[model samples]
Target: MAIESEVLVIGGGLAGITSALAAADAGADTRLVSYKQSTLRNASGLVDVLGYTPGGDGPVVDPFDAIPSLPDAHPYRTVGVDTVRDAMAFFDTHAPRYQGHHTDANALVPTHGGTVKPTARYPASAAAGLASDDRDTLLVGFETLPDFNADHAAAHLESAGVPFDVHGVTVPFPGDLRAGAKVTRYAGLLDANPRVSVD
Candidate 1:
């Protein structure tokens, strides 16, 4: 079946969600399609949104303002000063909604340069440790630099007896895993799980 939408978001990852939300907010009829229960479980979960905050317990150096001084070949050099400033402003506006009293009170805030406590939305300890009988097994094919151990994860799944499956797909991009390459891998994962309804 062919579904129509003004903005068809193919992934529910951070960038996708952010895009979908922004598009919808801008009056687009957005539809987010995901092949799994969440786009949060994969590499997206590894990202922490709490990089910097106003009144944060960290060094308080604005990453945007700091980007311009980096070496000529630095990734930030391409970002441009205006982009960083805009991002900093966006974060300044939205961060308060997610901040918690505990985070605000934390003494040591961790920053890129040093350790400084920053407000974050990580799962609470109790929630993180909760036992789950249901599990989804992802079968990753091909190797990339900084490889992850799927064998250990699979062993844990087997011990838990959670539902699982394995499959393989070739990587289109060989050698380096850049931003565009990662998106390709994400699409592959979605293709493998066609049953999921991306909403």
Candidate 2:
């Protein structure tokens, strides 16, 4: 048996998925093939347009403004800034769950490692936690997840001079899972039972 498609995307990673979706949206019969799990499954779910430049001293403030500064050999420069902007707009139109700052500027989002990253777009769920927001914020960490230390992250954010008041607390997740369980297991459980209260 054989399958037919007008557009054949060869991978399942972010780029491939985006290509396939774009092709399908353009009225093409697209088919995507992958040999392994998608890299998106392990990603932080942030759409980072440009975090840094090759020899830049700090994170980029505006990805569009910085595009001209990129080296000639860089992919962004090679494709031209207009193409990058069009790609981002295309992504925004298709991905309703993710959003950008609605401008050429980047949003600063805090990571689990106590560092803030500049991104053009992020998951809508993280909108309230942007470092630019001056509201009081609380970070809750799970005891089973050793990689993320909420208290330490809070302190680091304070030291980094974020414009918001932030605090952290560690608590055990409400489940019978072992301490050694992978983060995916916990995420799967939460997905399976959205009403699983911590209290």
On lDDT, the leading prediction is 2
Candidate 2 residue-wise lDDT, 22-58, digit = tens: 9998788999999888868888989977888888655
After superposition, which runs of candidate 1 have C-alpha atoms over 4 Å from their true positions? 1-5, 39-61, 91-96, 100-199
Indicate the worst ten consecutive residues by lDDT in candidate 1: 106-115
For every model in order, what is the number of clashing pairs? 7, 0
lDDT of 1 by residue, 1-199 (tens): 9554598998877667777777886787989998775646543222232344433434333444444556677655776767644553454444444322233222222121112232223233212221221334343433441243345444544454334442223343333345434544655665676564422
Residue 21, candidate 1: alpha-carbon lDDT: 72
Candidate 2: lDDT of 148? 78
Work out candidate 1's RMSD over C-alphas.
14.9
